[model samples]
Target: MSLAPRTCPPVYTGSHLDTVPQGGKYDGALGITVPLAIANYWHQLGYRPVRPLCIIAFAEEEGTRFGKVCFGSQALTGKLKGLDPTALMTREGQNLPELLQASGLTGNPFTPHFPPGKCFLELHIEQGNALETAGFPLGIVSAIVGIRHFTLTFTGKANHAGTTSMDLRHDALAAASSFITHVYNSALASQRQYVATVGHIKVEPDANNVVPGKAEISLEIRSETDTLMDSVLAGFQEFLDHTAQKYGVAYEIAKLDQIPPLPMDASLKDLIAEEAQAQNIPYQVQPSWAGHDAMILGHELPTAMFFVPSKGGISHSPEEFTPSHDIGQAAQVLEKVLRRVSAE
Candidate 1:
């Protein structure tokens, strides 16, 4: 939150409360702590910003058991208007209106609205090894990647595992496995612009003594552009069709979800780069592989994001970490950017 008096709406700097299941400690947490630390430093010096500056934290950002994604950002921006509050329930069944009332969702430190040209800057762990591998302490994000989800089902004749000969069997799981391999290998060959994952699978009779008769797969694909994702989907479908035919299985696909990519504010990126150079902090430009609230706010406001390195490029796990040196460097650059942007 801004240390200055709220004579008017403030410029914002903060991060969402990342509730991604198995999320790393720094994912949504450090972004807030570092800003709060800066706010405290300003208070200790009895200094007020030239413009109102706020440090706000958003929760339920990951849609992980906590609830739907980016709840706080969407709500504050009035994206929830006209929707039934009761219909938007938390994982625990807490309604939107009630949750806002219960949490006192708006006011001093929690305000989301600000001057249109003003900015929202966030600092986060890169969650990938882009910076870590390059030995950079910080990064300026270019864009947040888009995501697509698909469910593919395969059907084949079931037969006794002991009785069915290998030459006469139509194995659905085999076809699905080959399709998954194709998906992964193709994504890997897409020059890092595309990534695909098949994390969920279900097989009928799930038994040791049975030849699988049906299989279902949940496939996720991500990229910076819709066109690339669409092309990738087409290629994957072709491969799946051929693999299913070879295995004598029939297959179908369903689209589950999609979110388009959002680019960060260019002017803000320039400021961040200027600050990093001024502070002598090594930095580079990268894109966020994971979704974030900044993407939500970017739709309505000028938002920018910077990143520190995630140890081993690991995220969404207990091993997620960043060194204090890298973290401090990030905070330093952020504080400088905050001072410059708010003063302007």
Candidate 2:
């Protein structure tokens, strides 16, 4: 376990709004800390595990700085494509490779070192209402929703807002607004665990006096099944095309990221569930809406995840919280899973 220099931007490097908080020091930081504590406890007990245990601290899981998510784990799982350190630039035009060199990681940005493991498990706080709503202290994740991101650009004629008259103007923003509503409605109609978000929107020459000529929006869709996602995406495309035609605008969809949903190892999930039951810690099975390192590692080996309730379903914020008791319970469940897997 050697510390590697981070190739991605630091989590809270002067971003506009802080998604992570400084309150309890146990949000993302504890994911690494608890594992180390467990390992130290095992070592102190003079118990040599049958299998090797490696505690990993993944970089850029929050994706706050870089516009990409899961940068560290994706690199390890060989899922990242067209990643060039030199070509990478921040909002301030800072070079990524230079940043990595400044931090002192001794390897190519494209290549990551991963330890061979018989199984992988991550203990994290559930960033949603599943556990809290179910009156449970812990959750055994069944699967992680796959995510697909698309950048949609609509091109129309920029014209005078006042003189353009009623029907003569082709407004990109109006067309985009229609598409956005449709995206939401379509997801609801699917009646499944589907989520669609329009997180970013920008209009070229953002002036109130002029009709928007070009509008760009970032959209994301997540689902547990690839087939369901495909159907949703296809419908989204149709909506885009229809809206463009109706508004007499040119539109294109560019894919930013696509991560297929990951299913956790059933046996491991069951083991954690059994452990929770035996310990009298209320637990339930649920799906992860947010992607994580476990999703990436699940591609290679047996992987599972446990979640503790996040206060108010808040995460990625300084206010994100889980009680110490809940954290201890989740860690205890993880210890059982580790012990069981290591013995085999």
Candidate 3:
């Protein structure tokens, strides 16, 4: 019912976690605590459910240490195929196979197998401004957005800034800048659910007196529908090719990771909505822009997710917060839904 609990949970700090060095109070912790609270309430009331309930606190959803997100869920579902235990090194100079053996798990860590489930549900905080913007306290997730990470490199001649003629020079940084602009305009002009971000960029050369020779860009694109994602990516590819040719530079794009959009079960969504209505809670049906373990489980079993409002739509930081009343409301709604489902 509960996993590891923090000692001094993260609170409102003016600075980011990197500067302040604090943990978030609700990023991934709330999903576990809220369910435990619900179970405690039923125990206090001496009420027994018609069906059994199991709560799991997945080991590593954030991958903050290993640089591999969804480690627990991926291990459970056998998605860790081809993962070499010897190749994965930790901060403590530990490898995965050694770590597993130390913990008494004898087989390869990548070979873990989990049983099929009847139903799965995850309660989480809305990591975006959707619920707050919509003026709702709760939301039932309709789908989890598909994700794609792109690594792009633009190569051009590195020359002296003072001596190189503007007309004759091929500037890789300028070409990259053009593509960044296109990524913004195109995604903004597309469907409301489509989003694209150029998160990281690097320019080569000692820059004060040199024309940039190479540029590296890390681009991430997400969409609620796969078709829309494909369309936007195609547009981006065309623009990249055109920009490279026009600027007299060469470019390469490599897809680092791609996870397709996953839809929540229709029946489970309806059930949550009904429970929210019955409890007189304000709710909306929306899609999750961020990833979660529910997306991994939904691949095979019936899974549902309900979300509570996040303050200022901020998360993954020290400032992330959810009001106490909002948290209680979400938990009550969750309990109502689980009780209803147990009866069925």
Candidate 4:
């Protein structure tokens, strides 16, 4: 999908219009623009193959409207649960099914087909400091990390800030703050490549004069291994149980979503690496911290991902960019992979 704003809440609000250029010929529109160009190029070259080639513009990959990542991809992959139109809510309180219907998307995104394929490849900008740090123009991803998102709520008694003595007050936010710090330290203690983020937090009666009775926070943990992720989560759960017992508060840990980590097809990855070497493109095999559609698609198909360097490793913003030459190189790599797949 285009990098447009989604119709969800503050977190999900993403619009393609944000990336439109003043002159209307901007460079950073590679996600959609380049694929379109490649399809046109293949057509112009009269490259008719044994299998059908489809250039799709998937909707809501950014999860900007639903606070859920990989919505479109999940729907296609038969991973989405429940279809109640009224139950879905966006940031602005708009129903997701309504939005889909209004947008003329057939109102049933789950009906799409994702049959087995020879391979699936996605070309995206490497939204990190890796390529530039390694002085490479391209990267062949080895795996995409699995992500687990959670919504944590800590509940306690709300009391008058001035009337309650510091020693007697049951402050949920205070306990939550400590728990957040503990999470940080636990992840750091592992000394491995893992990320834990508490990106959103909301407290009831958020007033200066009142002790918070309830607080809800969003937490995300990503790691290359399910074992490490489970270990980190176990640490968090242990901390929560201990903190609640120590502080006389109640806590709830609700899993919002969990996606398994996906290692790209080793043979296909090696094939791409070989091709990159043949083309003399500076490339490296790296694991992706950020999740991508390729991770899910890779489960059923021989999938590989090609990454072009992002300028300063920025993405998901108007300034998110990679050079046009890098884009062209990635397309060339993708074309080569497609040709190889077609041959098989």
- Maximum-TM-score candidate: 3
List TM-score per model, in order.
0.87, 0.82, 0.87, 0.78
| Model 3 TM-score, 2 decimals | 0.87
Question: Residues 41-78, candidate 3, lDDT per residue (tens digit)?
Answer: 98898876655556666766777656677777777779
Poorest stretch of ten by lDDT in candidate 4: 8-17
Model 2 residue 31 distance off true place after TM-score fit, in angstroms: 2.4
If the candidates were sorted by their lDDT against the true structure, best first, what order would they fall in?
A: 1, 3, 2, 4
Displacement of the residue 70 alpha carbon in candidate 1, Å: 1.9
Off by over 4 Å in 2: 1-24, 64-68, 75-112, 188-192
Q: How much is 54 displaced in model 4, in angstroms? A: 2.8
Clashes of each: 2, 5, 0, 10
Q: Residue pairs in steric clash, candidate 2?
A: 19-316, 19-317, 20-318, 21-317, 21-318
Q: Tens digit of lDDT per residue, candidate 4, span 105-198?
A: 6656666566555566677677787898888888888789888999999999899999999888788999899899987887787764788989
- Cα RMSD, each candidate: 3.5, 6.3, 6.7, 7.6
What is the lDDT of every predicted structure here? 0.83, 0.76, 0.79, 0.72
lDDT of 1 by residue, 243-275 (tens): 987999999999888899888999999999998
